[model samples]
Target: MNRILATARVQLAAWPSTLGMPWLVLGGAFLVNLMVFALINTSNEDAHTGGLVTFYVVVLVAYVVTMTQYFPMILGMSVTRRTFYLATCLMALVQSLGYGAVLTVLELVESATGGWGVSLPFFGVEFLQQSNVLLQLLAYAVPTLLVSSLGMFFGVTFKRWGVIGMYTLAIASLVVFGGLAVLVTWLRWWGAIGAWFADQSSLALLAGWPALLTLVLAAVNFLMLRRATP
Candidate 1:
């Protein structure tokens, strides 16, 4: 347990990239959206900017880079694979919660200010507009976990398999998805699938599945790391 904490501390040492950059990007995106919406319309009606998507995408890339950069360093320091993996999971959870709190606050502020006084929806998107604070937090945090885990999975994959493996993985993934699409089309399940998705609560759709995926990816990442080399 101490070792895990120690390993996590090492990762946390690079706080600017892991913790600060995403929020910085989000703030910048919000300001840009605010300026654009404020200047263009000159109206009182609310607008949906969809700018928060940029922040989420950045978060995903951040985790990938985190793993690719940090894993080798820690491993070379003689840290056990298990400890490093556990530390990464810890970091992902902590960072997600921290970012989620910030996002929740921003959403509340956005609502209070009436979309920054111009009806722009930077933080408060239609689908994620939850009244329950916890749900809102989950909505924001779960995706972070999922994406971070995804990035870590890819990072470890690249470490273990190299460029050729990545290319192979990408091709395999495309084939798998394409096969699934074809199957869905042949079975005429698109409508039912759409209905199933629509029937789910927003929390279930956004948070539940992503949380499950995160766990699965974490497990897979650990497996990869167990046999991985620096």
Candidate 2:
């Protein structure tokens, strides 16, 4: 347990990229959105931008770097693969919770201030609005976990199998999804799929299913890391 925590600290040692970059990216995106929205003369109170996605993208890329850059270095320093993986998971959970809370606060402020006084809903977007604070936090955090797990999975794949492994993974994913798309088209399941999504609440769609997927991806990432070369 101590070793795992130590490994997590080691990962956090690169604070600039690991802890700072996401917020920096998010701040930049927010500024851009604020400027653009302020400049527009539309009276649409429902106007919103997907700028929040920048934070998640930065997090995903940061975890990819964790596997590609930090993994090798940490292993060289005598950390076990299991320790590193656990540490990575711990960091993901902690960071997700922190980010979720921050986002929730931002959402509240945005709502109270009427979208920063511009009538723009950058943080409190309509689709994601939740009356329950915990649910709202989960909605934001779960996707972060899912994306971080995805990045870790990709990084471990590279470490385990190198460039060829990545290419193979990409090709396999395309084939599987492409095949599923073809099957769905043939079976005329598009309507059912759309209906299934429509049946789910925003929280369920954003947090529930993604939480399960994150668990699956985390398991797979650990397995891959077990066999991965530094």
Candidate 3:
């Protein structure tokens, strides 16, 4: 437990760049988005903006780089794979929650200000707007975990197996998605699937699957880490 905390601290030591920079980028993008919308929003319709969504993409890239850049250094410093993996998960969880809380607060503020007087829906998507704070945090946090786990999984895969592994992973993903598409078409389940999704609450749609996928990816990341080199 102490070792895990220690390792997490090491990871957090770079928090300024890892965590702070992404929000900086998000803020800059948001300003630009707000300006664009303000100028063109003649209708004054509170439309959904894609600006904040890019934060998740930033997280994906950040975690991938985090793993690729630091894993070797941490391993060389005598941290075991299990310890490092646990620490990475801890760091990701904490970072996600922190970001989620801030986003939720900003969302609340946006609501109060009526989308900052521009009617731009930057943080408040109608589908994801939850009255429950906990659920809202979960919705925001779950995707961070999912994206981070994916980055970790791929980062380790690349570290352990190089370019060939990435190509294989990409190809495998394509095949799986293609197979699923074919299966859905053959079974005529597209409507049923869409209806099922429609039936589920936004919390279930956003948080539930992401939490499950995060677990799966985390497990895979740990397994790959077991065989990974510094």
Candidate 4:
């Protein structure tokens, strides 16, 4: 247990990229959107932008770096693969929760300030609005976990199999998704799929399904890392 925690601390040692970069990117996105939205002379009071996604993408990229760069270094230092994987998972959970709490608080502040006086709904977008604070936090955090796990998966694939592995994974994903798209088009199931998504509440859509997917990806990462070379 102590070893796992130590490995997590080792990962956190690179705090600039892991802890700082995402917020910096998010702040930049917010400022850019705020400026653009404030400049526009629209009478619509419910203006919203999807600029919040920048933070998540940045975090995902950071974790990919963790796997590609940090994992090999940590493993070379006598840490076990199991320890490294556990440490990564622990960091992911803590980071996701911390980020979620910050976002939730920001959303509350945005609501009170009338979207920073421009009625710009950046954090408190309509689709993610939740009356229950805990649910809202879960909604934000779950997707973070999902993306972090995905990044870890990519890193693990690279460590295990290199560039060829990444290309194979990408091609496999395209084939699977492309085939699924063709099947959906043939079956005319796009409407049903859209309806199914439309029927879900915000919490379920953002947190519930994503929580399941995160688990699957986390499990896959664990298994892959077990056999991964550095």
Query: Each model's TM-score?
Result: 0.95, 0.97, 0.95, 0.97
- Candidate 4: the clashing residue pairs are none
Model 1 TM-score, 2 decimals: 0.95
- Evaluated at residue 195, the lDDT of candidate 1 is 97
After TM-score superposition, the amount by which residue 181's alpha carbon in candidate 2 deviates from its true location, in angstroms, is 1.1
Each prediction's Cα lDDT score?
Answer: 0.86, 0.90, 0.86, 0.91
lDDT of 2 by residue, 1-230 (tens): 99999899988888998889999999999998888888995568656689998988999999999999999999998898888899999999999999999999999998898788887788787878887899989988899999999889888888999999989989999999999999999999999999999999999988989999998998889888999889
What lDDT does model 2 reach? 0.90
Candidate 1: list runs displaced more than 4 Å: 42-46
Cα misplacement distance, residue 15 of candidate 1 (Å): 1.0
Q: What's the distance in Å from true for residue 42, model 2? A: 2.5
Candidate 4, residues 80-110: lDDT per residue as tens digits? 9989999999999999999999999999999
Q: Candidate 3: where are CA atoms >4 Å away?
A: 43-46
**For model 2, what is the alpha-carbon lDDT of residue 212?**
91
TM-score of candidate 4 against the unseen true structure = 0.97
TM-score: model 3 vs. ground truth:
0.95
